[model samples]
Target: MPVTKATDADFRQLLDQHEKVVVKYYADWCGNCRLFSPKFKRLSEAEPEVAFLDVNAESSPEARKLANVTNLPYFAVFRNGELLETLAASKEEAVVELISKLHAN
Candidate 1:
């Protein structure tokens, strides 16, 4: 599945709609966030069953609060609209581990 760009307006709805969701919280000026974008997209394509979302942490206050996003390139996994875990990292391995948690359930 392709990563969907989400905002404060549609974040909640997307969460509610997908059973397994992985959100990548990023900021426009965060270089790491920009660098990890392609990896995130590739991960999304690999896991077709999961819903991947990209949200600007600086703009999406409501979504950012759900995961308590404190760093750039933060990743949060949600199952059935409930937050499971969050990781702040730029490494693809770390993001893969976070996404693995979704399948573990």
Candidate 2:
């Protein structure tokens, strides 16, 4: 699935609507965030069953708070609208591992 751009307005609704979600929290000026955008998109496409979201950490306070975002390019996985894991990394492997948690039983 394609990554959806989310904001404070619709973040909660998206979380509630999707059973497995992965959110990438980024800031416009963060270099690593910009660099990892394409990778995040590719990951989303690879995992069509998961809901991928892109949220600007600087702008989406509510969503940021949910994951306790403290760094750029932060990735959070949610299952059934509940947070399961969070990772702050620029590496695709790390993000992949974070996403894997959503399906782990």
Candidate 3:
């Protein structure tokens, strides 16, 4: 499945109602964001149980600010709406690894 877009309204419901989530903060003009998009989607397809949200940093200013994402392609994992991990890497493998680790917690 394609990555799901999360708006401010849908964000809370998805988080509060789910067990695991991978929230990706990205901007349209960001090269890294472009590169990471498919990889993130692939991961989402690989792990269907984990909810993946793609938020445009430009569009979701509040989410960007709340998540403290100063850079594009930021990654954060949440377990039942609680932050479990934050990753700084842009590589798909690193993201997958981080999610794997966080899921273990």
Candidate 4:
């Protein structure tokens, strides 16, 4: 699926509506986040069955607490509204593996 933007207001509710989701927390000024965006979008297109949600950390204050994101490009994989894992890095292989495992389950 195409990557969608979610804010603090509706991020959780959005995730609750999807069976499999990949939520990415990022900031505009972060180099790591900037570098990962294109790869993430490509992955979303490849894995159209999964919901990809992007959140701008600067604008979404509540996201920090909800996602517990300490790094520039934090990713959280969720299945049926429950968090499966948290990834602190911005790598394509790691994301692909997480989604594949979650979707398989």
Q: What ordering of candidates by lDDT runs from best to worst?
A: 1, 2, 4, 3
Native-to-model Cα distance after best TM-score fit, residue 101 in candidate 4, in Å:
2.9
Overall lDDT per candidate, in order of appearance: 0.96, 0.95, 0.82, 0.86
Tens-place lDDT digits, model 2, residues 1-105 = 999999999999999999999999999899999999999999999999999999999988999999999888899999999999999899999999899899899
- lDDT, candidate 2, at 4: 98
True-structure RMSD for candidate 4: 1.3
**Poorest stretch of ten by lDDT in candidate 3:** 62-71
Q: Please give, for residues 1-105, the per-residue lDDT of candidate 3 as tens digits.
A: 457899776788888877888899988899989898888988999887888899887887776665778677899888978887787679888888878965694
Task: Answer with 1 or 2, whichever has the higher lDDT.
Answer: 1
* Model 4, span 1-105: residue lDDT tens: 999999989988987899889988999999999899999999999987789999998899886567688887988888887888888887788878777867675
Best of the two (1, 4) by lDDT:
1
| Candidate 2 ranges beyond 4 A from true positions | none
> Number of clashing residue pairs in every model?
0, 0, 0, 1
Per-model TM-score versus the true fold = 0.98, 0.98, 0.90, 0.91
RMSD of each: 0.5, 0.5, 1.4, 1.3
Of candidates 4 and 2, the better by TM-score: 2
- The 10 consecutive residues of candidate 4 with the worst lDDT sum are 96-105
Per-residue C-alpha lDDT of model 1 across residues 1-86, encoded as one tens digit per residue = 99999999999999999999999999999999999999999999999999999999998999999999988889999999999999
